[model samples]
Target chain A: MVNPRLMVWLKGLAAAAVLTVALGGTPSFAQSGEETAHATDAVEHEAGVHDEKGLPQLNTKTFASQIFWLAITFGTLYVLVAKVGLPRVGAVLDAREAKISGDLDKATQLKAETDAIVAAYEKAVAEARAGAHKLLNETAVTADAAAAKRIADVVAGLAVKQKEAEARIEGQKQTALANVRAVAAEAAAAAVAKLAGVEPDQAGVDGAVDAALKERA
Target chain B: MATDPLHQFRIEQIVPLHLAGHDVSFTNSSVYMVVAAVLITALLTVGTASRALVPGRLQSVAELLYEFVSGMVRDNAGAEARPYFPLVFSVFAFVLFGNMIGMIPGTFTFTSHIIVTFALAATVFVFVTVLALIRHGMHFFSFFFPSGAPIVLAPILIPIEIISYLMRPVSLSIRLFANMMAGHTMLKVFAGFTITMIGALGAVGWLAGAVPVAINVALVGFEIMVAFLQAYVFTILTCLYIRDAIELH
Candidate 1:
């Protein structure tokens, strides 16, 4: 569609230019010089009339001149825009995009590094906690063993003292009983001798004493 | 007829000035150009500054102008020329407004003059050529020679190509100038006829005058279309030229 429009425009321009040239130019020399001059004068007169009416009279020379100047103006403007303005705008946009991308990359790298550091720190802390807990448990078990050993030693020492005390009490009781029996027997013999008054036979006295002693035992 | 339309083209001082022993006449053309410049500035600034999501009428018009030219450049020259949007847009607006504004009762259509149109055309021509040169370097000269042509045809084909290429600015400038001048002139002639006919005949003259008046009305509509079309054509050609420069085919 755009191509067609351009073609149409170019066609129109060509036709208009051709018309202007044909109208402006001198007629062919095949015609007499007089006819040529008359044709030229007629064209000039027509041009004058056109000028008075403020119409563009077809003139190739003027047309060519106009084209020359138009080209100059358009060329200058194009250079200014294409070379100067466009490059500046492109550069600014590029710089902005680069800045944004660079910042994003930096942020990503920093975040990764930070995460790694945090992981390392957390691992160290967990290891230290585990070590401390293990040490506490071992100390508690050792302390319990030591306390039990001390209590066992105290009970054994008490048992040995109790056994020695029992043996001493039994020996004292036995010696006291023996001494009391000796005293009673001597008293009995003296009493028996005083009551009897007569000199009895030694055998009878001995047999009676043996009988009394046997009965008392 | 004015001795010189170029002479008529002057930048007049709004304030009187005595500069280097010259008596300068402050003309209507200068005042209008200034007014046009100011008008363009105010319009674009005010229209775009609001930057509304749902554009107001004025802003929409501004946006439409921007989109239209940008679209043209994109479509005609391809996306690579997107960077040239502003330049293309500026040319469109300036020429479009300049042509339309001249249609007002008493305004000078600078575009009607050959010099102004030629200036615009020549600028496009030079830029396109320069672009081709810059992009292709010495190989840019190949553009004047047709591809896949026999060596025997070079003599005929090369001259034709060269002439056609050289004629671009001429065609571009004249197309605009001739259209605008002819359209305006026709309108003026018809308007003059309508008035003169009405004055000559009493009641009947009004009936006769209606012919030219109706024609003039139709011409007005046509001229409006032409004004816009001419501006569009000018910009589109510029884009094509730029495309050729960049692509060098």
Candidate 2:
């Protein structure tokens, strides 16, 4: 990441260098020298890290104050840490530790509770399935019994109707046999009259027809 | 214009004063020291006020400081040195902040001073020594002589042992002071090269001048790492000294 930024910066610098060269103006050393002199004095006046006194660190003149202030500052900081800072930080750490362990305990408990609920639900579903299966089997058995009874009823009714129709057909056949006997009598009487050239008696025809029909039976 | 790299280390009296024949003038060093202390205080004070479980950046920093110093103390000095964690931690913070603050172009570095570093080191040395004496009484002297060492070698070994023990404070103080001074001086010198080169010439000089600027940039990054490492080194070493005093190494 930094490489890309650095590349862009270098590219910009190169561009700037090219622009400066294109403009191609000479530097003003004389004027800068005067500014440099004043700047150095100002820097010395402010920080004064070097002077005729040598390294200010090694200089004995400022040692007392530095030490004095150092002692005061160091003591105050030490007091702040020992009395105030460390205890608060320690408490926060302790609380965090307790909370972490406590949260773990709660998570474990919740997991156990969920596992138990899942098991119970599965058991209830299995029981409900068994009940439905048992109900289906019971319904099937009852419907099978009902269907068998209905079929038996239909068969009984058909047998009765068939018997009634057979009786009615027998009555019609008897009536037809009687009418066929009467027609046979009439036909015999008419044949006798035509063939013998004389009218046949009804009594005689009846007798003849009765004899023939009896012989055929 | 004095283009000396050493010029950057000078201390000037912001307000000159005298008290009991001592030159106790408030200087830039003093100012930077106070600034470091205040910054450290303000950071801990405000950052930790929320005590947020999910930490913000400032709280995270504060917690980082706490855990870092506490772990350092526990690791170096064992569980018993838990009491001295605050002082050790505060000193580390101060030196760490002072070094980094000084890295800025115009700020003073108090840790570069022998007087300042020595003062801090001496306090640790005295505290550890006092603790050792109070705990061990005459037995603290036994530290100079190992149990297995022959009595014949005791004459040479004891003085050497004493000298080395005394040198601990000096070496500790000089290590931090020298590192900060050397690093800052190097930066300043390289910075001078950039300024002089860029100021004295034209377009070609800018290209040439970029060399020092590049070096300064790398140096700045390295110096920041050095600043953090030195503070840790100083702290762990202090804890080690305290451990030695307690355990009689």
Most DockQ-accurate candidate: 2
The candidate scoring highest on lDDT is 2
Write down the C-alpha DockQ for each prediction.
Answer: 0.03, 0.24
Model 2 spans with C-alpha error above 4 angstroms: A1-51, A109-217, B199-203
Q: Please list the Cα RMSD from the true structure of every candidate, rounded to 1 decimal place.
A: 10.9, 13.4
Worst 10 residues of 2 chain B by lDDT: B1-10
Model 1: per-residue Cα lDDT at residue B25: 27
TM-score for candidate 1: 0.55
Residue-level lDDT of model 1, residues B131-242, one tens digit each, is 7887899999898776777888789777767767888888888888778877887787787777778789978889999999999899999999999999999999889988
What pairs collide in candidate 2?
A48-B10, A49-B9, A49-B10, A50-B10
True-vs-predicted CA distance for residue A162, candidate 2, Å: 29
